[model samples]
Target: MKKEEKSKPKKMKWNALVLSFLILLIILVLPPFAGLPVAGQRALAVLAFAIMLWVTEAVTYPVSAAFIIALLTFLIGLSPPLHGAGGLIGTKTALEWSLSGFSSAAVALVAGALFLSAAMQETGLDKRIALLVLSKVGSTIKGILFGVIIVGILLALFIPSPTARVGAMIPIILGMVSAFGLQKESRLSALLILATANTATIWSIGIKTATPQNMVGLNFIEKAFPYHISWLKWFLAAAPWSLIMSIVLYFVLMLVMRPETKAISTGKDVVKNQLTELGRMSGSQIRLLIIAFGALILWATEDSLHPFDSTTIVLLVVALMLAPGVGVLTWSKVEKLIPWGTIILFAAGISLGTVLLKTNGATWLAKIFFNKFGLNSLSIFTIVAILTAFAILIHIGFASATSLASTLIPVVIAFVQGMDNPGTIHGMGIVLITQFAIGFGFILPVNAPQNMLAYGTGTFETKDFIKIGVILTVIGYALFILFSLTYWKWIELLP
Candidate 1:
């Protein structure tokens, strides 16, 4: 039985890889349709190949990214250039375009953010902060649950990576469960763990740097539109929606997955003991806190207070944190902590999206999509509802919010650009709102890395996750519409 289980994954990968190659061949060979340029047709084919590989888990992300870059170099290079006096883009120039995403400031910010997450982990600061928050919340189950959300919110501000924030909290939360003498699978355990996972997702909606997907959205927005979304401006527009959803999360989880007891009488003591085990805060922790806090201020005041952008600020923070005699982490230690595969995949995704836009593939596809749905004739409110629903439903198949955002945001930008709205409907607003829906990975453990991290604790069943997840998804969708009609419109995010 164990042998069969091991072989199953190998078989699945072979099948998926075979299917991906077949799809790529068909698209490349099929006669052009929709008046798509030769380069555009080839770009769409590569995109379909990527989506299939990504959705099916046919290969590791960095491996798949390497495949994508290679294919783009050859396929796009062989096709006629989109413009200019050239027979073909040529493999040399095509490779350059394929690697262009590495040059983006978004890529730099993501790398810097990863370094910060590493520092938090290396110095054990993330764990200390989480335990400190729980220690102060008292022993009541309700208080602990609320504290989990609070921890998520606070960490999202300081830690830019969602997985790292949730990663830090999971062990501490499980410790609290053990301290209370509850079984790992107890209702109380499930409740607290689920809340921790959901809170991480909830707070990510508000903070621009909390997740990579938000950066993916910003990348597309900056490339396709004439707008620049400052950090403060993003907070002003999206934070209220996230705040309301955070409240909704508390109520829904409380009602659906009520714990066996109202209080963990020893919860506070366990947390206190854990905090005591660490003794006093170290110099490393204090220095990291100050540096992170200063960086946060710079990010929040990007456009208003000074001229430095968020990416530049993060780079500077990372440099300071790694400098000799002044930093919390060394290069060798931090390098292992960072997921270079994710960075490679991130850069590849940006390059693919840029190619889609540059070749007009996204525009052509968007036109067909809008016309098929008759969205072009609908009110902006109706359009938002339809698009947001599409975003939510499609998330079921995506394991990475970053992949979803990269694959779809470019098309969404093109969709908005093709519309007739001049000023009233801001493409940035529509893209931003849609980006929020892309974070709705509540339906399954496989929907996100954080969800999977929590699920691996074995404190909750799949059915339990599904039940609470369904509720969260519905609430998230409803809240999305509510904000669209009221706050989003008042703030000029919608029509």
Candidate 2:
């Protein structure tokens, strides 16, 4: 019996491996015969092959993605516009286009914001705020859920990147959960916290420093539209929707889990005791708060002075927080707190995007869809919104949000032009919708770093994520479509 069981598994593995290789061979050889652009076909084939490896767990997801990037860059080089010797070396024109995204301003801004988030986490400022909020409003499970939402929003303002924000907050959240005795079987409690944190990623789209995708949106709009949407205006347009979605998410969580009232009581009493243990806020905590608020003001008003760009303001804040006399930040601790993988992931995404756009792969794919469907501007918005939701749903196969964003943004921009009003407001609307939709990755343990962190606590199951995530995703998409059509018009940003 034991030998039979072992042989069965071996046979399955051999069959699966053979099937994958055959499928890969077919995709590689068939696309050229189908009259597809060689570069675009090759890019699609490579991406499909990577996805297959990721799904089968043949290799780690990031490793698979990295492999695709290397294969595309080295094997194919430049396609079509510069063929033969020109293609081998890459055309001067292609170099100019691809290198443009490597802007010093974008890199500095991202690094500075990352440093600030690390400083906050290292100094214990985020924990203090979480404790304070829980102490004030966590008497009930519902209250705790609301508190989580508020804390998540505040963190988003400072952290910007969801992976960083989620990672930094997970340990703190787990500490609180453990204190309250809310374990994995307490499904409702776990789902509520995860939903609050995940949904907050959408709200961060309102700020320039929120994520690299926001910056990409801004750059695309500046190039394609006659006007620019300021950070404040973008916030105004999306904030109401964010608030509404958060409330809906809270209620949906309650309905799905119907957690026993007893679970709420266990955590409340424990949290109160922990609050007593924390005592009053320390001097370091107070200073960190001031630095955080000051940084926000600078970011909000970055356009005012000629010399003070978003990058400069963020760097200044990081410097102040890290300064020796400040005592709020320690070099040794901050070094440990920083998420180096996230930074590298961001850089790689940017580089890959540069290659795609330079090689006209993005445009080629866009043209295929546009010609096949005959979609106009409004139709394009609908298509993009739907595709964005689907992308988020299957994002477990993706290693990083930046990776997903880099791959999708160009295609999104191509569709945006189909809209009659592809100006600042419409552009902002599309960007916000895509960013928010991407956060709907609630199905698997590995979908987003935050979900993975939350999963690690052993307080939730994959099914728990699916039940709540599905409902929230539906609500999110409905809200996105409504906001794009009506609210944006009321704000005079959409046609």
Candidate 3:
């Protein structure tokens, strides 16, 4: 009886593994039949499978992404024998294509910004800045919400990763809320703050290296447009919308959470005291500030000079931190600070995206969808925006913005391309907006790191999240469409 029971369990386990593999196979094989090329379709299949695994926690997110990369290289190379490598090293061209993102100047810029963010955190400069802002803006709940938006915007310029920025800010925001005697789970306030921070990072998208998706958009623009917008040009074009959105968000928060003046004023002294405790910026803070600003200047002007690339600049900054005079940053300390999972996941995502594009699967998908739908650029924009907003509604189910971006951007891009617009570059605005909207997953604690962090403070509830999040979503899409029609035209990036 014992032996029979054990055998039954073993059989069940085997059946489950076989079922999983079959599902993956079906997903991978189906795309080719749907008019996507085999290699590209297979890559999509691998990505879909990987995303499922990631969402289910069957494997870590990074692990799933990495596994997809390996599967793509093996499968794509074997079928086509990419440049005669016959699946060993992969076709030389395939290897080059897969690794292209690593060599991109934008990736280096983002990586550099990450290092700078780490340095700022190490010196406690970011915390000091947050306290300073809170002291000045903490007299009202509305003011504090505005303060969070302001702080998030400033941080976005320094911290490129939304996840990192939100993770860094949540503790400080929670502390302020606690001091105010506000319920941490109060849906309106907490959810608004999360949305504000995520929205603020959208402003950074105006800067060339502010986010990896920005790089992807830039790459697409260069490919499709006769003219390339420089970093300065890009910033000038998008900053106005960013500023407008930030202000709108501030008012929206106030409207949703009409907390009484007494509640708003309750925590003023606590925040003020925290400011006092930080005292003045120390020498280390001052030095790190100089280094941080210096790196930004270099990054902004990277395309101007032919000297060093963005990655080298980051490596140099990291190296300087190890210098005797700098003393604050050491290799031992700095190495431990890197978000290694993010880097690996980023590399894998870029690799997989490249394979999908290279295999002609993206193009093939584009052809079929475009042929049947007969949509123009405007229709494409509307559809993409609507779908993106819809995805934001369910975003809590996904783990990271990057994961969401990686999975969806390709499909959207293909859809836009299928429209076959002469002003295809204009489609980039849709891509940028979509990436930003993914940050809208504010209704659920699991939607974003900041949401999760704030959720745990026990002041807010799921109902609060849903209430505030829905309003933000409505307002955000309105702003997105308005920006798409007016601001994009003014910038001449759109017709």
Best by lDDT: 1
Ordered by lDDT, highest first, the candidates read 1, 3, 2
lDDT over C-alpha atoms for residue 317 of model 2: 82
Off by over 4 Å in 1: 83-86, 422-425
| lDDT by residue for model 2 (1-495), tens | 999998986776556556655665676677362444565555565555544554564544445445655656643455554232443434454344434555635656677687777766666677767666766775677787777777777777877777666665566666766666656456554765566556555555444566655665455445545664555555777678777877887788778766666236566666667667768877877888888888777666656543376667777887887788784777787778766555544554555555555445566666666545665534545655565665676565664455566666666666565445556556656655665555455556566666676667666677877777777667777877787678866876555
TM-scores for the candidates: 0.98, 0.80, 0.82
Indicate which candidate wins on TM-score.
1
Query: What are the lDDT scores of the predictions, listed in order?
Result: 0.87, 0.62, 0.63
Q: What is the lDDT of residue 217 in candidate 3?
A: 48
lDDT score for residue 69 of model 2: 55
Candidate 1 similarity to native, TM-score: 0.98
Model 2 residue 283 distance off true place after TM-score fit, in angstroms: 4.1
TM-score of 3: 0.82
Count of residue pairs whose backbone atoms collide, per candidate: 0, 4, 8
Candidate 1: tens digits of C-alpha lDDT, residues 288-329: 999999999999999888999999999999999999988999
Pairs in clash, predicted candidate 2:
180-267, 184-459, 377-418, 377-419
